[model samples]
Target: MLEVGQSTWRHLTLAQRARLLGRLHATVSASAEEWADIAATSKELEPGHPLRGEEWLGGPYAVLTALEAYRTSVRALAQGESPLARVRTDAAPGGRLCARVFPLTAIDGLLLSGYSGEVWFEPGVTEAEARRNAGLGQLTPTTPAGVGVVLGAGNVSAIPVLDVLYELMASNRVVLLKVNPTQDALLPVFERALAPLIEPGFVRIVRGAGDVGAYLTTHRSISHVHITGATPTFDAIVWGPGANGERRRRANRPLLKKPITAELGGVSPIIIVPGEWSTADLRFHAEHVVTMRLQNSGHNCIAGQIVLLSADWPQREAFLDALRVAYEAAPRRSAWYPRSDEKLQGAASDYPDASWCADGTRALIEIGAGDDATALETTEYFAPILGVVSLPGTGQEFLDAAVAHANEKLTGTLGANLLIDPAAEAALGDGFERAIADLHYGAIAINSWTAFGFLIPTLTWGGFPGSTLQNVVSGMGVVHNALLLDRVERSLTRGPFRPLPRSVSALAGPGRFSVLPKPSWFVTSRTGATVSEGFTRFRMDGNWARLMGTLVQAFRA
Candidate 1:
């Protein structure tokens, strides 16, 4: 299957590629409900629960969006225009180019509300260089780079499909995707949805355990490899295991020579810049913090694990109290992802002083100040455990110290989030912007959760670029960058301090300008599935009736 795809993919013309992507878009749209159902069942989510919306967005909707973007790029290429010509670009500091990719139309703004995102090219990437390298492998049809192996992630259903899309569309490579054993129940669904690529011999989906993955990774026919998994897995694959792995890593020797790229997990942080706050503000952000930790049952790589707070802030205790209330209010979700229980147990054992909040089905362990090398700070607890660290400083001093800590002390450079009151932001002024510039993360979100950077297809998702085999912190390379810009350093997504009317933000407060019926990300909401599906449909087709229905459902919740 891989050899056939390797041979046939190179011959596909731009028009043919566009058509193939269009077919994929149709397949996903048609299979949306079934796909969502399978994922919900696998994750133990109730059939009609709003949390099923997570499956829809992370599964079919994500694939459909990527297909549309890839199709647009290929179609533009066929029309003799730059694939990135539609993007608006500006110059950032150090000669980097910032390309605004989201909210491409006014309809996007109307649908998303108060949200905008951009990808910054690497330093010294001029406008001309960006335009020149925008399409890279797709601009002019090139020979296939042989069969590529994609080791899929078990947590997010969309990740495997999107990884396949990136291989085919961005790099013009054929793919052999190995589904993670944890979620291999969806093999039939993948076979159906990816039939277009399979029929054309451009892609192949295989179900597998670790042994199967090991065989495929070492196969001579496979020219390159990409994985969305942990750093240890990458190490085991590239440098053997245990003592030998450490030896090879130190000697900079890799067993597998073929090029490998990965999107690994991280201990993501949310730096809260202290400021005066109203009760409404506190409530709004309390919900925001809870959503950040509890979303996807806390299995997400970009979940807000470490929350940095200012020790001198007067509202610190008030905000913490509100956070506790919000956390307890959210019903415990099923820990369905692989190893979630084990990870949670490890965290509990390491920090016996940790405050435990569990109702059997879900858990939220809070760790207070401890040594920097403690498990709570150093380990990527892929569960509902959040560590709160208080730093001394106020205003710029706080922001500067926080930035330094986040950049240096955090485990991975995958992504980070910052929550600051608008007044506090105004007070910091240029210092806030400077602080943002200094964050050594692949994606950063301001006044919002970092998950937005991953959810938005246009934003480049990966580490901050310079990782190697020996020091693969968050792995290497980028994905989900629809625009195909070269040398992308990071993605920064900014949102309004307060929720906009009709916005689906988790940060919406009691009296603030909120228009949603209920927060779609909340697993406790009875109508979560309906609201999620409605919002997704509205985004895909912009149907007013669906939007109205979703709003009504939200209100009912």
Candidate 2:
């Protein structure tokens, strides 16, 4: 398989690559229903369950977006235009160049109003340098870099497929994708959806446990490796186990010599800037916070694990109360991922004083200050548990402390979220922007969940650019950067503190500000599957009627 892909990948023309991606997009769109069903069944979700929306967005919808982006790039290359020509660039703090990638079209702005995002280039990358590197591999389409082995993630259905696309589109390499055992049931669906690459021998999907993965990682045919998993898993793969692993890590000597890129799990934090918010604001953000944590049943690598609140903020108690209420009201999800129960039990045992909102299937734990060394603080629980900690100070002081804690004390550098009221943000002035510039996270989201950085195909998704194998915190290298820039430093995504009524804010209700409708992403919504499907179709076709139907279904949800 590797030999076939290696030979075939370099022979394809730019136009041919665009056509192939278009075909794959069509295949995935056609198989959207089956793909969602496969994911739902694997995770024990009922038919038409709201969580199925997750599978759709993460699977077919995500692939479709990536394909469109790649096709756009290749088509531009076939012409005499640079793919970066259409991008809007500006200077960011610390002498970084920021490019606005999403909302490329007016319709995108209409559909996702009150939301915009940008990718930040590495510091000292002048506008000229960024434009030069933006079209990295497309200039030499026939140059092949050999075969890559993608160790698929089990938690999200889309991860394996996305990793394969990145290896093919970004690196111009063929892929041998090893599907995680937990999601092996979706092999048929993947085979059907990604038939273009498989038929041409550019990609191969296999199933395996640790032994199979180890063999492939050490295999001679594989030139590169990418994995979406836990930090410990990456450690065990790159270094031997137990004492040897510790020794190798200490001595900066790795057992594996191949180039590896990974997107590992993190103890992501959401810093809540001290502010005076209305009742509606508190309620809306409570649900928003809950959604960030509970999405994917808290199995997501970018899930918000810690809520950093201000000890001096007068509204702290009210916000915590609202969070507890929202957490309890949200629907419980089955513990689907491996060792979920054990992880949750360990957290509970380590912090017996932590507040629990568990009802077997779903749980939320709130921990206090002195428990900093406990598992809840240092470990990625990978379960439906959120830890809340309050720190001293107000205004910029609190923001600085939170950012320092996230950078110095957190387990990973993958992603982080900042939730600040517009008023508070304005008052902080330059201090707010400085805090964003200082954050060590690869993806920094302002007033939105960091997961959006992962979802947006144009945004660079990986750890902060400078991680060594000896201390690979979030795993190095990036994926899903449609512009194809090789010197990407981080991705910064910003959204409104409270999205406009016709936008995302409609999803949260029970307040006067809510005017639009319920959002399909809500796990409590029964018609989420129908709504999400309609939205996916709309995204593919851009039909007004389909969009209307999707909105109607959202209202019903």
In order of appearance, the predictions have TM-scores of 0.94, 0.95
Q: For residues 1-557, what per-residue lDDT tens digits would candidate 1 score against the true structure?
A: 67877677878888988888888777777777888888888888876565678887777767776777777777888888776788889987666788988877665565456678988888888887887787767875766678899999998898999999898777878899999997778888888889998987888888879889989999988989999999999999999889998898899889888999999978888888888787877887887888788888888888889888888988889999988788777766677777888988887677666666656443444544554435666788878887788899889999999999888888999989998876688788778887888889999998767777787777789988889888899989999987777899999988765653433334443222334433556555667677768766765676897687777777776
lDDT per residue for candidate 2 within 1-557, as digits (tens), equals 76887788888888888889889888887787888788878888887465778887777777777788878988988786777888989988899988998768776565455567898888899888787667667778788888999999998888889889888888888999999998888898899999999998999989989999999999999999899998888988888778999899898888888999999878999899989887877887888889888888888998999898898999999999999888888776777889998987887777766566646555556655555555666899888888887789999899999999888888889999998876678788888888999998889988767877787788889888678887888888988887787688888877666634533433463112322344456565667778777767876777897788777666675
Q: Residue 455 of candidate 1: its Cα lDDT?
A: 73
The 10-residue segment with the lowest total lDDT in model 2 = 509-518
Write down the lDDT that model 2 would get. Answer: 0.81
Which model scores highest in lDDT?
2
Local distance difference test values of all predictions, in order: 0.80, 0.81
lDDT of 2 at 386: 87
Give me the overall lDDT of model 1. Answer: 0.80
